[model samples]
Target: MIHQGRLKEDSLMVMKIVGDAICANENQLRRYLSKRQSASKTSSTLKSLRKYGFVERHKSHLAFEEDDEISYKPPAPFTLGIGGYKLMNHLYPEHSFTQPEQWSKNSLAIQRYVAMNEMRCLSVEAGVLRGWSWNPYIGGSAKYRSPLAVAKLESPQGEIQLLMERPQMAQNFIGYYRTKLEVYRYLYERDKYFKIDGFSKANLQIVCLYVSSSSMAKFIQEEIRLHTFPFDIWLLSNEWISEEKGMSEAFCTVNQDGLKRIRIPFLAPKQM
Candidate 1:
């Protein structure tokens, strides 16, 4: 019971920050970071990353001893805290953060607000979004997941870094989630629109949808339940894909224009 929750950018950074400190845990991580989120939110933020088993929680206390037995380093040249700083300084002489002599009162003269904004763009929050994009990412000739429409960039700095990507798709499923009624309304409306497009045989269309739709995920989950109907439906959105699992067996789709754009958010909901 590490009390894991969805890992947001800042939360992930908090984990990295506190995790790298002399001795820190979720409790200590909170005490050191100031944010506008709630108490429970702060607690649950650690849950999702447990998927990767990145952090471990103890029943009584959190212990951090650099275990020689463990091989838990992030991908190449990536380190979290002071190690990150030192690594970046050595790797990037021109932009090395360690040398203040290289910095000037007027060097990169940017307003505090502007500088902060730039920092935010390169922060853990932004990086998580980039990593979690619902965007189509197909890698390797045979891989179906297309590359992200807008990719994330990681810039190493002294104990800091950035993740580049779009924001909406990775939104927290809190107040951001639509009400059940609202979701249904949106579903009906979008379904109507798609029906029209299907009947119209439109060459292309732009459909605005989000990837957090449970109905969509449900459809994918029930891919086994997909039954062939006389009619066929295809999703065609570049950025959004509704991955329904059972649908693969029930129906067939055509990859059009180097895009198998699926309206990934429009699957039928579970039967309650």
Candidate 2:
């Protein structure tokens, strides 16, 4: 347990990771922490941190309880506590830290946050995650839409600037996606006009869509077939990503030439 009004090295690292992601669950935090540490040890650390007001744990309702495939529920997610926010502010004065309000009240938004944290963990394990940000703005002017998350991945070929979106299943999601596609296309055409740190039109290689089921994946894929996008649009299912294999599993995309299957480049996980 933390004492002496001070945090240990591991505790500080945990707070930083949670602060960076805005919100992450216990399992996700364990995956990102040192592999040498046992699960029990990680849990102990979190308990201590919470006790000392370094982190806050938020319980999540079973938003996907209607889905028959899910046999178990996930754990509550964590956010920076008052102490953690102060530490982060001291560590990186330029970076702003805002506590997410009503994070658990909106089911869809919470699900998306959890999914993004999962992806972030995968990237960290693969050792290719150069940088990551949540809800990043993606256009030239102030009137720009933010993707769910943005990540910069390093590979043998080059750096890949990726924009990720996970739209909840809805009646008019197809139209929403088409409009999003058009905005991305517009940014791609006028790449020179806009510039954001670690993101650019030339380097934006993949726009990944994380859906909930195979049917939704197929529905989105069919809609994607109607348009020609400058960047690759990959469709992934939540079930597949939650499996033991994780991102190692292959995902499919639809282009002018029809459907094509592909894996993330340099996706080998670090040996434990």
The best candidate by lDDT is: 2
* Model 1 regions more than 4 Å off: 1-8, 59-272
Q: In candidate 2, which residue pairs get closer than 3 Å at backbone N, Cα or C atoms, i.e. clash? A: none
Error of 1 at 67 (Å): 30
Provide the TM-score for each candidate, comma-separated: 0.20, 0.82
Clashes of each: 26, 0
- What digit string (tens of lDDT, one per residue) describes model 1 on residues 106-213? 222112112122222222332321221222322222233221122232223211111112122223323222232233234435553222210232223222222222
lDDT of each: 0.29, 0.70
Model 1 compared with the native: what TM-score? 0.20
Model 2, position 38: C-alpha lDDT score:
70
